[model samples]
Structures are given as C-alpha cells and as structure tokens.
Target: MPTISGAGFVVTTLNKILAIAGVAIVLGGVALGFRSVSAGGTVCGSAFQPAAGITPMSCDNALNGAGTLVTIVISAGVLCLIAAAAVKVVRDKVNA
Candidate 1:
C-alpha cells in the first residue's frame, strides 16, 4: 500500500477538512433558510407583509437579507466541496 508523506499528507488532510466543512456549511444554510421562511411567514403574515402598525419594509428587507445570506453560504459550501474534489484529482494525477 502506498503511504502519504509530506505535502501529500497535508493535501489529503486539507481535502478531508474541506469536504466535512462543506457538508456542515451546506446543512447550516439549509437550516437557516427554513428558519427564516417560517419565522418570516409568522411575523409578516402569509405574504410577508407586516401588520398595519409595524415599521414599513423592515420585515421584507430582513427576509431578503436572510435569503441572500443563505445563498452565499450555500454557494460557498459548494465551492469548498468542488475545491476539495479538484485538489484530490490534481494530487492523484501528480502521484500517478
């Protein structure tokens, strides 16, 4: 069996970390999105419109912000996963 050494070991470790982090981040984003939708719906009614006396547009802006944040988090997680895969491919090609 071939053994990983030096930079190869570091790369392998980093790849594993990245993959795990990506999965975690993706899950977190999904959770956050669900929470936001549910909470926003409750607070702003079915259509995300605030009640008559509440501050105008605040709820809408918050919901939009949450959506943007979720998108960014999920995109970052996917990029991390892709980077990890790319690293593995490159490392294998180099070793081969």
Candidate 2:
C-alpha cells in the first residue's frame, strides 16, 4: 500500500490542467482560423489585396497554422505524459 504525497499530487494535477489548457487553446485557435477562412479574412496576407479581389497568402501562412496546431497538440500530449509519469514515479517512491 502506497500513500501519495501532497507535492506529487499537486504537480500531477497542475500538469494535467496545463495539458488541458494547451488543448483548449489549440482548439480555439483552429476554430478562429476556420472562422477567418470562412469570412474571407486573411491571416498572413502579403499586402491585403482588395483591388484585384484575390487574397494572397504565402505558403508560410498555411505552414504557420499547421505548425501551431501541431506544436500545441505535441505540447499537450507531452504534458499529459509527464503528468502520468509523475504519478507513477510518486507511487513507486511512496511504495518503496
């Protein structure tokens, strides 16, 4: 029988919260991006072309959005793994 310590529990909980927050932020950003695209709003346009009636977006803009989402998901997953690892470590330590 192992007893969990206060510090370990708190750290694990905080890490889980941070992971959730990161996921939420990523989802929110993606939703905003979809809204922008649907509304014909350019996020990273070259010069905001309204005369030619053609919005110009560099490959970088698409890359940025994808990269951001990927980064967020990775960060969230890492944080969750860290939290799980911390819980395991604490349990092992307490048991030992």
Candidate 3:
C-alpha cells in the first residue's frame, strides 16, 4: 500500500475542508435567502433590500432572484472551492 506523507495529507485535508465550508456557505446562503423570503425579511437588514421601500418584502423581492445577494454568496462559495483546489494543485506541483 502506498503511504501518504503527513504534509501531503494535511494539505489534502485542508483543501477538502475548505471545499466543504464553501459548500456549506453556499447552501446556508440559499437557505437564508429562502427564509428571508418566507419571513418577509432578512438577517442582512436593509442592505439586501432596495434603495427605497425597505419593507418586509424587500429582501424577498430582491434576494430571492438570481441577480442578488444569494447569487453572490453562492458564487463566492464556488470561488472559494476553486481557490482551494488551485492552491492544492499549486502545492502539489511545488512539492513534485
């Protein structure tokens, strides 16, 4: 059986953790968005709402769509995973 080095295992584990966190962040953001719409508000306060008419439905009306904070969060999560993978790749290349 091939044995993995401690450093190699640590890096792989870190990358996997980052990827998992990114996925969690994305899913949490989506859940939050749905909760916001259902509750007619958001935890982000007025920030995620429109410039005016900052009412209960503001978060729902704005963030429930694709072009809103939810999308940004999901994109960020995907980017985070991509960055982690890139880092792992770079590290592996350097080690090799």
Candidate 4:
C-alpha cells in the first residue's frame, strides 16, 4: 500500500476550494446580469440614449445573455481544471 503525501493532500484541498469559488463567482455574475437585463437597466448605471430615429436597448439587456454564457463556460473550465488537478494529486500520492 502507498502512503499519501502531506503536500498532495494540501494541494487537493486547495483545488477543491478554488473550484467552489469559481462556481460561486459564475453564478453570482449570471444572476446579476439577468437581474440587470430584466430590469432594463445598465450594469454601469449609465443612462443610454438611442439615435434620433433608432431605439436603444439597455446594455445589460443586450449583453447579459452572451455574458452569462461566457461566464458559465469559464466556470465550467475552472471546475474541470480543478477536478483534474485533484485527481492528479491523489493519484500521485497513492502511487508514490
């Protein structure tokens, strides 16, 4: 049987924490974006005006969907990286 290294354990734990934080940040960003869009408000609190004949939508309304999707993708990527790191740490520790 192989023994686990202290460094490996610590690294695995840190990776888990990072994964959780990444997910939280992504969720929060999406929620805020949706709220801003639904409220027809700008995330920056700036008032937007359309051209003389064109009607303008709020920046949030225009950008939130794509922004949320991008955030979610990034979060998923972080989660995958964390998971991979954790697995590598554990495998290394167990095989050492």
Which residue runs does candidate 4 get wrong by more than 4 Å? 1-3, 37-54, 57-96
Name the top TM-score candidate. Answer: 1
Q: Highest lDDT: give the candidate number.
A: 1
Which residue pairs collide in model 4, if any?
Answer: none
Ranking of all predicted structures according to lDDT, beginning with the best and ending with the worst: 1, 3, 4, 2
Q: What does candidate 3's lDDT look like per residue over 1-96, in tens digits?
A: 756789878888888888898989888766655543323433423323433444545455444553466778888888888978897898779778
lDDT per residue as tens, model 1, 18-70: 99999999988877676633344445422223345444465666667677878
Q: Candidate 3: misplaced stretches above 4 Å? A: 37-68
Ranking by TM-score: 1, 3, 4, 2
TM-score of each: 0.77, 0.42, 0.56, 0.43
lDDT to native, each model:
0.75, 0.53, 0.66, 0.55
Candidate 3, clashing residue pairs?
none
- State the lDDT at 90 in candidate 3: 87
Q: lDDT for model 1, please.
A: 0.75
Better of 3 and 4 by TM-score: 3
Stretch of 10 with least lDDT, candidate 1: 44-53
Candidate 1 or 3, higher lDDT? 1
